[model samples]
Target: MSAGDIILIPNRSDNYIYLLRCAKSGVTAVIDPGDAAPVIDELEKRGWQLDIILNTHHHNDHVGGNAELKEKYGAKIIGPTAEADKIGGLDVTVAEGDTVKVGELEASIYDVPGHTAGHIAFYFPAVSALFSGDSLFALGCGRLFEGTAEQMWHSLIKFRTLPVETRLYCGHEYTLNNARFALTIEPENTALQARVSAIETLRKANRPTIPSTIGEEIDTNPFLRADVPLVGKAMGMSGATAEIVFTEIRHRKDNF
Candidate 1:
């Protein structure tokens, strides 16, 4: 299958809505439509019709446009099975191990519950794209809103196992803040420092620093590096388990 074209649509402060078009089948889908206006505008601009609405969670910023988009284009609303009630207008409720098809492209669903109880992510290995929503970010992870640190840690671990080159498409544009917080954790990390510099340049130009690869996050994101001895040592928990180290990192980020 040919790789699909992914377009970034910025809306509602920092929220990101992705419009994807399958190259081979010409099928179109929107991932996490935080607002209908932007999604509708993009679709109309491209002369494309929406076929599917993929929601990662029930957060307002993620599913707020579901009803409108569905009503307008008769798009199929596919969302997490656990939050089917919370996410109204869901045409298909999916869980881990299920596969969702967007035209000729197929995505593997992962039950990534941390930012929200029913949070999930879609991974299209063929294209090396992961629509992570709020579960993971460019240089950070989402806050533990409705889940525990342990749950969030495990959820991140799932992402860590993906191919190093997998492109992560998260829900928000929090990379600048996340990069600053990450510097506080690993000031000595040259890789992190360089990434911070690049991120600074991107933010200065008001460009999105998103679609960060898994390998980039592994080398720089403090949350994803909780298992590294350097990260644990920096937190004064060198001998502690990864979960314990991760909890501390999350706590500090909450206040940072």
Candidate 2:
């Protein structure tokens, strides 16, 4: 495996569980295990020992395999402290601004509460990677499950402030659906149109759409580009603030 190689394990049809392996150290840390079988298979295939399991939220699709993996590999279960009650067998509950290490890589946790009121994204500044679990998706954002629109907006903005080259590793494979809705808000964005076509092709091939970069998302993602004037006009909410328009767009997607 390449150094710092990310292996994506497709789970539950739409969800993705990732394994981050340090090629130099032979250490592996998994990010969200929705199922145990696939993770186990991957680990066994490589004869790797899981050092840590990172959980962004308590959602079953994110933490379902925690107990089993922790038991089998003796991996440390790291979860968000804000939703301690939701996570099982959490050995270390972290909060925003806290740092966790995966081999030589250091992940800085951000409290991005919206999808689950305690959802956190891990930022590896050195690698320019963000593990956004159900919070941000390509051409989309997570539903307002336990957070207000304003709160979610703020959380997303926090990510926007990161380096534009940062890579985003989201939890689910929702690119096709998100890309469809993106056109409603950004009809003038030919980049969005082209990206949507690419995503559609990937979906038809049953390939996972993930590991998108912040720059690409900024260019084509409607949710992340609510500040664009054309997007605001397309939403039928002219003269409205970007935040207001973004909320409306999110609502429309929620009901769709």
Candidate 3:
């Protein structure tokens, strides 16, 4: 079966709420609906029935609209089993390796706990779309609020193995700022420099700079380049382990 069509819905300052619709089955799922009004309105606009509420974590910004949407559409809420009690209205609790279907499409759940201990991500192999809530961003990674730098690094390593063509659908519109921080650590990276130029134009136009390909991120994101000699050298850790370089870079970004 083919994967569903996806749309990014801008929500609450910088967060993105993803909407996935199966063309063949006409089933629709809203991912990380921080707010209900916009989602409700959008469903009405498309005359689509909301069938699922897919959450990545327990953060209020990610699960705030759970009750409202569940009440409104009787949508089944699927969330991380680790945070089922924290995230209200969950109908299915999933963990790593478990799969959830969106109409004809199937998404594999991954435990990417770093941004939060219970944070997870959904990956649709058919579409190569990764709904990386707070764990991974375009040119950056998530802050260590509930988890540690070590945990975050390990979590990112899992993503490093995904196909280069995979598309990253992260939660925030933090690419512009992340690009600036990345340039500081890898000033001579031509790929990042080129991406920064393009990002500047997009920001000037008030456009989104996300849904970046995994290949693009591998070439540009400093976090994803921790193993590269230049990136490690930039942090004065040229001989350090990849994990060490990753930790240091994350520390710098924490203060950036």
Candidate 4:
């Protein structure tokens, strides 16, 4: 169970499609393919056959390419059991505490419902990577479309418990905008300020500001810091509970 090699492929608008290959068994998988063309092109370029399609939620952009990829390569589609009806073509449906294997690599599933109820994340401890589709982002969490702020906060708490070094492979490229919005929340945070500068540089160079570690997010991401007293004070809600503070943060972000 060696660390796998993960490739980030940008897709429609800001969606991200990750292609991962197990170092030990050469198993290839695509995570949240928003479109089939880009995934197919990348697979052809690398001359690797797609072995599995791993989806996190039922969003159209997340599972859009499932049928085409499965049809072309006979790949198995593994997605969240809660969203089984919405996410068609799932050969294997998994829930929280379930384990999924890709060749010699294994991933633990976590139920992280926020942007969508029943959304799940895949954590490959062997590689210290979390393919967090739409639940947690670089400096923000996904919008609470079908779930509550409390639910999103709890979901983020699950992410916070992971090892700080875990590399977060989120589903979108919204770091730049998220950074700006985060600054509005914590104007004097030195770490957040420094991260903003770095994010600006990366976007200017047309580079992805992804794979942000959990430690980095914990330091600069306001969404993850809702439980901290400083964050509550900054929001003018001193001594508020984490859930109340988190709800305010989400409300501001929704309007930001």
The models' CA-based lDDT, in order, is: 0.93, 0.87, 0.90, 0.94
Q: Write the per-residue lDDT of candidate 3 for residues 1-256, one digit (tens) a residue.
A: 5557888888999999989988788889999999998888888888888999999999988888889999999999999999878987789999998999999879998898889998999998877899999999999999988998778888887888889999999999999999999998999899999999999999999999979998998898888888899888877787998888888999899999
RMSD per candidate (Å) reads 1.0, 1.5, 1.2, 1.0
lDDT value, residue 190 of candidate 2? 86
Summarize candidate 2's per-residue lDDT along 1-256 as a digit string, tens digits: 3348788888887899999876677678999998888999999998888999999999998999999999999999999999999898999999998999888788899998888899999998766789999898888899988998778877887888888898899998888888888887777888888898888888899887788889888898877777778777777777888779778888889877
Error of 3 at 228 (Å): 1.8
- Assess candidate 4 and give its TM-score to the true structure: 0.98
Query: In each prediction, how many residue pairs overlap at the backbone (N, C-alpha, C within less than 3 A)?
Result: 0, 0, 0, 0
Against the true structure, whose lDDT is highest?
4
Off by over 4 Å in 3: none
Candidates sorted by lDDT, best first: 4, 1, 3, 2
Summarize candidate 4's per-residue lDDT along 23-121 as a digit string, tens digits.
Answer: 888899999998899999999998899999999999999999999999999999999999999988899999998999988889999999889999999
Off by over 4 Å in 1: none
lDDT of 1 at 108: 95
The per-residue C-alpha lDDT of model 4 at residue 201 equals: 100
Name the candidate, 3 or 4, with the larger TM-score value. Answer: 4
- Candidate number with the higher lDDT (2 or 4): 4
